[model samples]
Target: MYRTILLPTDGNPPARAALDRAIELAQTYDATLRVVSVVNLGDAGILSPETVPVDGVRQSLRGRAEQIVGDAVERAREAGVRAESEVVVGVPHVEILDAAEDADLVVMGTHGRSGLKRALIGSVTERVVRRCDAPVLTVRAEE
Candidate 1:
């Protein structure tokens, strides 16, 4: 039933697993896949660094996001799924939710971190699941 699927990747192992799942779903449904990677400027409340030239960091992050999305596109192509990619700079959860507005579904990876680790880092999937209007599929990373 999905026409356009949005897969957000962080280039992490968990995200790779999610990409695999998204590709499989896209292939089965003959859907167009939009792979997005959001480059977070900083953690929580802290800004990266004013002295370090924010533009340079943003450029670097975008480059990395491009590479990540490019790799996913290649994989999707091999699977015969139509794929497109975009890189955005912002909080991961916010960007993911925004991108989902035009998508039929949003697929994302959950690290499943809990306790102190989860409390300290927070989960993008959690936020996206709460905010997104489209159907969200969350794949948890294997231990």
Candidate 2:
């Protein structure tokens, strides 16, 4: 019943697992896949020095994000699924939530962290699950 499927990736193994699942669902439902990779500029801001030009760092992250989404879009197209992708600069969960607004469903991967570790590290998937309006299907990373 899904018309549009949202898939967010960071080029990680967990995200790769989710990409596979999202592609499968898109194929089954004849849905258009929307793949996105967000560059968390805040993290870079904290690590970068005043001497380092922000534009250089942003361009680097943007390039990487573009590659991640481009690869995902290529995979989906190779499987004969209609797909589009974008690279955004923002907080991961916030950007994902914004993208999810137009999606019929959101498919993503979770690290499955729990308790103290989870609390300390936080989770983008968890935040998206909590805030997104559309239905979210989470694929856990294999340990």
Candidate 3:
């Protein structure tokens, strides 16, 4: 029932399973895969002082994000699915929700943090789940 599936990866262990699932779903439905990684440039910026750690950290984070998306696209392509990827800089939940506007579904993973811990730290996946324009399928990561 999906035409384009948006998979947001953080290059984390939890995200690997979700990426695999997204690729499988795309293949099964003959749909396209769109992978994205957000750099979260809220505090880390390229314009920071040249010698400040933020500059290097931002560069490193962007490189990692690009690699994650590129790898995901390659994996999807190898699976015979039409796939594309993007690297965005913004709040993870915001970028993901915005991207979802053009997607049919969002497939992502959750770290399974709950209760006090979950309350203490809000979840991007949870935000996307609550505010996404399209349907979202959240897979729980293994402990």
Q: Against the true structure, whose lDDT is highest?
A: 2
Residue-wise C-alpha lDDT for candidate 1, range 50-140, written one tens digit per residue = 5667677677777888999999999999999999999987888888888999999998988888899988988989888888899899898
How many pairs of residues collide in each model? 0, 0, 0
Worst 10 residues of 3 by lDDT: 41-50
Worst 10 residues of 2 by lDDT: 41-50
Listing every candidate in turn, what is its Cα RMSD in Å to the true structure after a full C-alpha superposition?
2.1, 1.2, 2.2
Error of 2 at 32 (Å): 0.3
**Predicted candidate 2 versus true structure: per-residue lDDT over 49-75, tens digit per residue:** 799788878888899889999999999
Kindly provide the TM-score of model 3 when superposed on the true structure, using C-alpha atoms: 0.91
| TM-score versus the correct structure, for each prediction | 0.91, 0.95, 0.91
Question: Which parts of model 3 are misplaced by more than 4 Å?
Answer: 42-51
Worst 10 residues of 1 by lDDT: 43-52
What is candidate 3's CA lDDT for residue 112?
86
Please write out the lDDT profile of model 3 over residues 1-143, one tens digit for every residue: 99999999997877888999999999999999999999997657656766778867888888989999999899999999999999988899999999999999999989989999999988999999999989999987677
Candidate 3 global CA lDDT score: 0.90
Q: List the candidate 2 regions with Cα displacement exceeding 4 Å.
A: none
